[model samples]
Target: MLELNFIRANKSRVIQGLKIKNFSEEDLQIVEEILSLDDTRKEVQTELDSLLAERNQLSKTIGDLMKAGKRAEAESQRERVGQLKEQAAKLEDSLKDTKVQLEELLLKVPNIPHESVPPGATPEDNEVYKAWASPLPELSSDALPHWELAQKYNIFDLELGVKLTGSGFPVYRGKGAKLERALISFFLDEATRAGFEEVIPPLMVNEDTARATGQLPDKEGQMYYVERDNLYLIPTAEVPVTNIYRDVILDAADFPVKMTAYTPCFRREAGSYGAHVRGLNRVHQFDKVEIVVLQHPDKSYETLQEMLAHVSGLLDKLELPYRILRLCGGDMSFTSALTFDFEVFSAAQKRWLEVSSVSNFETYQSNRMKLRFRDGKATRLAHTLNGSALALARVVAALLENNQTPEGIVIPKVLRDYTGFELLN
Candidate 1:
């Protein structure tokens, strides 16, 4: 959440930022309403405090008057105190209502877009940050899509997946399964080598963890629920991995903490369809390696670029054609101030598929999680960031689709050692 004080002080700037993000003018008005409500709340609390102070002084005066045997004066002071108490109670109620108003409005507001963000409404408006390695490979019109190639190689069984679970879940067999495992291992190793501590986070997280990652209140419908236990099957490793720092207060020495985790994530995909859901593009359950970082507020944006570079390096190693896109405000997540999506070209499909998203949430998650650090001077909120080093399913899908030669599927040179094979027939 954006700081209430910052929202109050920078209302105009925030509104303009939202406009760049394509938020309606009505949302701008709602922000103004929150500031107005905050002012009213402060006024009511001030009045109640003043009334309480007056009552206390009068109570002492009544005691003194009673001791002096001035019964009439004591009686009058008692009546004044009673009236003050009644007024204070009413003020307290008004203050409570104003606070509720402020909270409701604040929840509806979106984060201010960074000045660097392009003014646009959708992904089509996003500017490509950069491309990795070289130009994309050419695909013939008859190139088999990943799903078709999966069937030809006997690697993925969508029919079996649907029988066991649902449509979005696909079962992997033989080399495909091993390849998935290898991808997970390779991603974890590469991230660990880059100073990230690897962790195996729980697949199911409690309500608190979901809220810490900004998935509960607004995105509850998009995740699977263990109804009996009231736990949410994690939608991403970001939920469990990042929440580890929830409610923590670190020293300045712990300025930039980096961690990575590999986990199977579950998503509901309640209402999704068409070509976008083909193959590994959208799945109910998928494996992914994620990197989360907590950095000093001053160093957050820089850390975000560092993460981008790390992901770009992996793409380069794999020799995949990919592009980095700056997500526009309308396309940005509720918790992220900024986001960069990584897309890999699928030659067989002749399209680009999203493989990862690296986001700098700034203090949005930290504020909700109460993750702070003591800087000796003040307790400041830490900047939080997370990115998929690579989501295994989509990466494999892209690899399979792109590496399809008439002979076999040639594995990327970097992953060959991990997979223990040069090609899959």
Candidate 2:
């Protein structure tokens, strides 16, 4: 949510940002509507304040009149006070209603894009922030895609997953299961070494938690809801992990609060179909290691770079060929002020698959979460950032497809210790 004062002061800029974000002309009118509602709120508040002050003065006069033995005069003042009370009550209700309307409109407005964000409307318009300069690994004609490789090695079974759950769910078997565990351990260890505190948050969160992280009204359709309990299955560890600081206020000294978690994310990819969604390309449930940061506003962009470097280092260790893309305004998430996505080359599949997305929300989330830090005499919203150190499904797909050999699928050296005997055969 945007600070109301900011919107009031920078209405034109807010509208411009929304336009760049692909908001239609109809949606753009919301800004004007919000301002109008705010006007009503202020008018109601001023009237209520004046009315209360007048009533207080009249009640004091009534007491003085009664003490003076002027019973009739005091009774007249009492009647006037009763009328003022009724008027004040009505004004108070009007003020409350206006505030509710203001808040509802504010919630509909998305975070403004940073000035540096490119103006575009789709993924194709995103800039290639970093290109993969090295030669992409080439696979032989006989080389198999990850799904075929999985079958050859008895790695994971989509059919078994269908029997147990549904399509889009894959059950790992043998070395595939081991690989998943090894990747989780490897990512967690890497994060801890980089000074991030590891946390194991609950997989389900209440509606307040969901809304605090900007996942409720925006991406609610993608989440799995436990209707009876009113809980949502987390779509990403970012949702729960970042909410840890919800409603928290910290000292300025806590400039960078870093935390990480590994979780199984659940997303309902409704209406998704075709060859692009094959095997692990898209799934309802997937394991991922997420890194979240709450930073002082001035240092947030700097922290974002550090996070990008950390994720890049992981990919380097895994020896995956990858490139980073700076997402255009429309391609970015509703909560992200700026985002960079990492795509790894899948040799057998002959494509680039997104494996991670690092973003700096720049108070977009902190505002909604009420996460703040004290700066001198004033409190300010902190900037929140999060990234997939690596989402395992696509990483595994890239690993299996890119590492295929006449012998077997070779595990990256960084994960060998975790997997014990790594070469999946």
Query: What's model 1's TM-score?
Result: 0.90
Q: How well is each residue in 7-55 modelled by candidate 1, as lDDT tens digits?
A: 8788789889878877777756877787778878888888888898899
Summarize candidate 2's per-residue lDDT along 330-421 as a digit string, tens digits: 99988888999999999989999999999998888888899999988999999999999989999999999999988999999999999998
Error of 1 at 319 (Å): 1.7
**What range of 10 consecutive residues in model 2 has the weakest lDDT sum?**
107-116
User: Candidate 2 at residue 188, lDDT?
Assistant: 97
Worst 10 residues of 1 by lDDT: 103-112
lDDT, candidates in the order shown: 0.87, 0.93
Provide TM-scores for the models. 0.90, 0.95
Clashes of each: 0, 0
Global CA lDDT computed for model 1: 0.87
How big is the RMSD of model 2? Answer: 2.1
